[model samples]
Target: MPNSNPAHTSKYEESGVSQTGAETALGHLLKHVLPTRQFNTQFPVKADIGYFANVIDLGNGQGVALCTDGVGTKMRVAELLNQYDTIGIDCVAMNVNDLICIGARPISMVDYIACSHIEAHVFDQLGQGLAEGARQAGISISGGEISQIGEIITGIDLIGAALGHIHLDRINTGQHIQPGNLILGLAASGVHSNGLTLARRVLLGETPEMQQERVHQYESALDRTLGAELLEPTRIYVQPVLEMFEAGIDLKALVHITGGGLLNLLRVQTQNIRFVIDPVPDVPPVFSLIQQRGDITDAEMYEVFNMGVGFCIVVEHANDAEAVQKICKQHSISCHGIGYVETTDAGHNEVVVPSKNLIGSGSRFSAA
Candidate 1:
């Protein structure tokens, strides 16, 4: 049977090390391996901005919008590849996708662009990509800010806020998540704009010849260059999800798997629920290559990257699941039954990996 323990033997294991020492090293690694914090600390909740924004009753419905995310080191990749068009799409996808997590239908977005010196072509590409992304998400680019600080800025920084509206009665805030609720995964569009720091460290660290060779290998394997593959526009699911809700399907919870990966599911507020992801979707070729090349552990990969599945919706165990799946299929998107929820300690939380091994397994009852 696969080892239930989170610790796994690595290629670097030495024969002379004592079991206790090995266990200590493994434990230390695990401690830093997973994201300890609940969410991204960089994106703080802004209460002051809401003072002047237009208000919609959304009648009893929660305005489940998220002002989360930044372009991160992906900008460097775009700079290196001399491609600025797609990064704007990523900026929009990063925030709008989070808005949909709580069953919010994205209505409008505003971007923040910071640059030391803005070139005309760069601005044009960014604008084009943002327009394309907004069109795909069925939202409007209401307004945005472009700050020019010759000293404070470097290349370019792109971030945005997405506004979404959901009926209070229709929001999937995980309140309905029960022990038997099914976890459905929506496949990602290649990396969906996270974990580039590690990818650059691992894949781009080789010699020039090695870099070219690696890129070629990735293209052959994944049918796209490593740089292009990593920059694939983020999948926008706002319309599909909103349509599902409009059709009267009861989605229990929705999760946008970003920097925290599958662990993001923990952000949902439902009592006594534990998630068991027994059959995760296959990891895309790019991720497999990175994992094999860097010798990254499963826990580390999930913590740092979205793997293959970008978005997930927790739904009831009724025939409506088929209807939801059909809608996703009509959009040419793939879905999978990743796992189910179970009643555990009142506030205790657990994420059981496929090997029956618990990684971010811990008790949240005290905090809850």
Candidate 2:
């Protein structure tokens, strides 16, 4: 089991991102934002305020799932490496992956790009990446806006809102997730889009010159330059997941393990259950490099980065788990039954990664 540190500032906070701060700030924001849900009764909101995605009842027994996300400090890597092509894929993956959690089949997206200055090559590369991502997700880029707000914007900002379709009755609100269900983890391509701030601060360096020196160096374990590894595009799980939906697999819950790591599993609507992840997959090489370089704790690493799993699916029966694995394998995604959901004596929900001796609740993970 991993050792626990005493209460103090986490290394991630030192990197300039605060998980607790964000939660508090978000609460204040939601206080103002959630009331707007009553503004339009014709298309009532289907999901609650903070599921992976929100669906709007469109009448006629249909719902449209929608979500918006952007590439975070991972964009800094693109700016540093002069690579602007792949992050569009990251932007797309971030939004669409969330939509799938609600069992929506993505159909279209609109993008918004804000940059300090208009650079022709950068825009061209971004378009190429967006086109490719849309192709992979089987969605169309309906429209977009590009703005040159030099005073307000820095290098660049890429964000998109994705829309997907689902039958009102078919929305997977995770209400069906039960104690006997299994948790299946899907492989991540690399770091994905989360935790890059800490990753950069640790692996590259805090100073610009130091980061420049390190980003270009070849890493033997990665077999590529450090910047390239960091810039790797996020994997889009739409096809395989949609196939599972089409196969009549009882997907009780779908989780996109993003900024909160394994703790994202708690977003499911189920109650009085804890997810216990044992026999977790091996940590990928890039994450290992970050941990060793940063001297980060196991609890912190699992709470920040994906470690290895990018996505998780909850299914009621063992046979359903096997069917999910088969579908993912056919799609070339490595899937494993890493854990099981169990009834918890504690009233609140939790995520327990036993190998690391860590337990997570609400917004953060602590050493057990």
Candidate 3:
């Protein structure tokens, strides 16, 4: 368990971004109106408005899943350190991870890079990381666009959109998730590309010491420079999840713990099921250091960053969890049995963090 909360401040809110505000802003945007048919096929599009990725049915038990995501504020850390290699991996991981949440096997990806000016060597280095990521994810970089939008952008912004295939019958829609399902957690590779905005504000905020310091000057509890620790690329979980799928294991739901932190778990859940997460396991040392340095409350930390758990798997039974853990270990990623699912009030979707008064509502955190 983590240390008890004392007086703590919210880093994300102070940084001029609000989770609630982002959600509200999205509400007014034009709804995605899908045409009834494309090419006169009998199969229609599966309206995947809330899940991790949108599934487009192509009939005959075949479907395509597509998702797009960026590396978020993690780019700032990379810029500060002058390292551009692993950020590309973060970009691919963000998209492929989301695609697999709906049981899609990522087939290929295309990247979009926008910047005022990018060095030739920098692009080459980024390509190296992207290739490595595609290999790890078993995908290909088919095509992309790189635009030099002078003056309009000051920093490099990289985004990737990935497409995958899945059998609709094999999709883990969470509609079948019921009481007594085991919740399995896959350990993160450090913070894994989210919440760097709050982290940067906490560590390098307007201090003379920071101005004089280099990324290597700060040593992390994980026995690495803070820059290297923060630069650790996001882990790719596609292989293991797909392996389980191949082995005939039924994945009830997949949560690629990202921007909303543990709250990402709620995207698949409905009002009838309450996901009761256990008190987090011994958090990674990197996260502990962040919490202490930022004076961030446990609830806020869990809400903003992954707090050490990168991916979550909801299985039909405890035996299924053990099997999944075994598969994760074989793939060389750390794994843990984190929590379970249970019955809840109708249309009352909630994720209860055991032993804490923190529960995730639809759009924000609320007192349990």
Candidate 4:
């Protein structure tokens, strides 16, 4: 259990991330941007603004799923460690994982790199990482752009847009998730490119010099340098998920648990239901270390980080849940039945974790 001391300021906000603030800004931005669907009536958007990915109907019973994501502050870890290789994989994982939520087969991606300087060796390493990520996702790096703006970008920024193919008839909008459906959790590999701002502040110290010194220091708890642990690339779930699709498993909702933790479960298309996570997967050591060191509350930890589970799959039948676990097993990814859904008339969705005494509404979680 994490510390529930209210005396502690919101750890994530103290680390300079305001989830509520971001949501408020996004709400305002979407009100103006979401209306752009009228701009192209021929290929209108299929998914709403807040879904993992947006699908655009392309006619002929086909649709294209599109999403964009970046490595976020995880890139700073790479910069401090001077290891650019795995960060590109994080970039690809972040984008393609979202694309798969809509039951889309990721086909291709285009990367955008903005850097203060164009060093050949760094670019080569980033390219290698991208290639490895593409291979893992079974997608192509069809194109990219590099901007050398020394004044604006001190180190580098890596972002990408992924486009995937989905049969218009088979798009998963979570409309099928219902009462009695089980939630399956896939294990995460370390932090997986989120909450780094808070993580760094907690584990490695706040200042750059302190972080630089601590990054190379080994702790018995992790049995590795902090930098190495933090640098673990985001796991690419493309193969296992696509295999599950091919195996005829009906995945009602596919969730990439990035940044928002379990609260992300409420982002599905289903409404007026409550997700009850009774038995969360074992808390990974790294996350525990962060919580202990930061004196962060359990609610704050789950709100900002993946904690242990990185991805979630919702299935209606017990056999389908078993199949999901088996598929994940074959891929060497750990899976568990963490919770179930129940129909509710509360007029809004909620995520309840009984073990933690936490219930989530909107973007944040609080003690029950």
- As for lDDT, the candidate ahead, 1 or 2, is 2
TM-score of each: 0.79, 0.98, 0.92, 0.98
lDDT of 1 by residue, 1-368 (tens): 22223455421222122334644776777576435332644432222221112123333334444465667767867776778888888888887887776666888889999989979999999999899889889999999999998798788889888787655555455667888888899899888887776776566653545544554344577776787876778888877887887897878887888765787787776666788787978889988877777776666667667889888888886576787888899899998888888877745566666552445543111111
Q: Would you list the rank order by lDDT, best first? A: 4, 2, 3, 1
Maximum-lDDT candidate: 4
lDDT tens per residue, model 2, 311-363: 99999899999999999999999999999999998889999988877888987
Q: What's model 1's TM-score? A: 0.79
RMSD of 4: 1.2
What is the number of residue pairs that collide in model 4?
0
In Å, residue 346's CA in model 3 sits off its true spot by 6.8
Q: For residues 148-258, what per-residue lDDT tens digits would candidate 3 score against the true structure? A: 997788778899999999888877667778788888899888789888777766655644357226455566367877778878999999999899988888788899999
Question: How would you encode candidate 4's per-residue C-alpha lDDT over 1-368 as one tens digit per residue?
Answer: 56786566788888899887998999899899988889999998998878889899999999999999999999899889988988989999999999999899999999999989888889999999999999999999999999999988699999999999999988997889989999999999989988999999999999999999999989789999999999999999999999998998988999999989988888899889999997878998899999898888988888889988999999999999999999899999999999999988778999998988898888788888
Per-prediction CA RMSD (Å): 8.5, 1.3, 2.8, 1.2
List residue ranges in candidate 2 displaced over 4 A. 1-3
Clashing pairs in 3: 271-348
Q: What's the lDDT of the predicted structure labeled candidate 1?
A: 0.71
Candidate 4: where are CA atoms >4 Å away?
1-3
